[model samples]
Target: MTGEVAGGRVPLPQRTAEARLIVVARAKRAEDYDRVLDVLVEAGIRSIELTLTTPGTFERLPALTDRYGASVDLGVGTVTSEAELARAIGAGARYIVTPVTSAALVAQAREAAVPIVPGGLTPTELFASWSAGASAVKIFPAGQVGASYLKDLRGPFPDLVAVPSGGVDLDGAAAWLAAGAAAVSVGGPLLGDAFAGGDLAALGTRAEAFVSLCARTAH
Candidate 1:
């Protein structure tokens, strides 16, 4: 599972099944982040994205990676700058995600031989990111446009791999997948009230629901 893109060979992280359901986690505290991630992993969610906005995220990456590296595919998200991208790679992130498409970010990922999922809304933006060598173009706020937008986008860029992020809930996961999305990135709906001291058991239930939804939608 290797391919050359922008003069660099794509790594396993860029070419694996982990992308099918990327769980985005944003916590106010690192401890809460760890707790949520542990529960998610135990619930059978292997792909996890830790947002840079979370406090102490960068500092905790090493230990997090060490603790779950074997069973989890850990990635860093919400990266908006080249410096943050560098920090993520240095912290041993398996993949990198951004909320905006940046040619510089794509180039940096190419240089580091890491996988990057850059965000975009319009078709032009998505194509631009793909042209710049993004492993996958993330359709941020996908809920705004819904699955039909993804279906429409594929009509022109059939080869483009897209991951619908933001506001995607269990009810809509299958629709997104059916619309030709390579995967889906979920946050709040999937996390429920876990970040605000909600029940871990409840979070686990939601995680299982998502996992089940993805399984049923798998082609």
Candidate 2:
């Protein structure tokens, strides 16, 4: 199954490498999701991930892309199963991320040359995913392990594209990137119920700061 989404697209690895910061927004409503998208766009954040667990994401991806695709690399996170992969492609997901590695899914992505970032926790698991053709291996629940662990992982897997997701914040985003992460995913801190609260301005500020912080660390 070729993995190309509706539009002929750029590959995910290129997008991740170019994106200094990736914002993962988990929201319960379309309005909230849109609000977060707006903030991220306004703040010059070019990469955004709307997790499958986020309510209204499936309904919102297309519209969001229609409006923001020119400036953003829109993606779906926490994706599992071939059905979700097909749906995400239909919704114009430019990138796909999963909490675990699946060979079938990797094959599906590779068929179309689209990027697939699979999650893995251990050295063995991470390398396994890499060997399976994952564009990047996500260190899920990274906050629990901390940036120091990333430093250690890189020592052995210097060429690996390790993305530290979950519990990552603006303060640690730089550290992760500096440690050789292709990119870092920041959520909770960027949205933090602000969307549900309808606080777009606050969300915008947070997004801008996070972008700025990532930029600073990247250089």
Candidate 3:
């Protein structure tokens, strides 16, 4: 798939499925995004999701778009309300990601021509999001359910597109992809101390590691 929809905007599903790894970033401060994102982009990480839990997400999103629009797909994650969703889109987020399943947000994103991936744990919640026009459903806390859960999900909903998020380590990411996950959304394990006094050089190394690993499983 080209990943683009009616408005020429690349849908989230196509992008994530192709990239195979969505780096979930959290920073204590907003300005830290510049260096962190720079390291990730230079390391060949194509898709990055900045969370609302971080400060200055809405404020700095536009600048981030201008800074690294081509090399990386910049999106907002940890969204919970329609207002936050609206702000994210207005601030130049290419896509939206929620930590919970909200069909209202999914439907709104569909209407706006922006692909959204909403999180859910149960089959019912996931199916509701997917059916509601979600670009892809996020299988939250994927480590808890294990890769086999996705294999099971395919039994009832063969076409269910899932991005396994939350607690997915490097090996877990590979395992999930092997189990047929559309992509893997990874945070802490990949990022480590990059946000704090952690070594950015090592962060770049980890970023490259995950990117290389994910690329091996590309659809």
Clashing pairs in 2: none
Which lDDT tens digits does candidate 3 get at residues 9-71? 335645555888999999997899888888898898889999999999999999998999867
Q: RMSDs, each prediction?
A: 2.3, 3.5, 2.6
Query: lDDT tens digits, residues 141-202, model 1?
Result: 89899999988997889888889998999877889998878888999999988999899999
Order the numbered candidates by lDDT, best leading.
3, 1, 2
Superposition TM-score, candidate 3 onto the true structure:
0.94
Point out the higher-scoring one by lDDT: 2 or 3.
Answer: 3
Better of 2 and 3 by TM-score: 3
- lDDT at 152 for candidate 3? 94
Task: Give TM-scores for every candidate, taking all chains together and pairing residue i with residue i.
Answer: 0.93, 0.89, 0.94
**What do the candidate models score in CA lDDT, each in turn?**
0.85, 0.77, 0.86
Give the least accurate 10-residue stretch of model 2, judged by summed lDDT.
Answer: 1-10
State candidate 2's TM-score: 0.89
User: Which parts of model 1 are misplaced by more than 4 Å?
Assistant: 1-19
Task: Give the per-residue lDDT of model 2 (tens digit) for 120-193.
Answer: 78888888887777777889889888888888887788867788888888778877877778788888877777
**Candidate 3's C-alpha lDDT?**
0.86
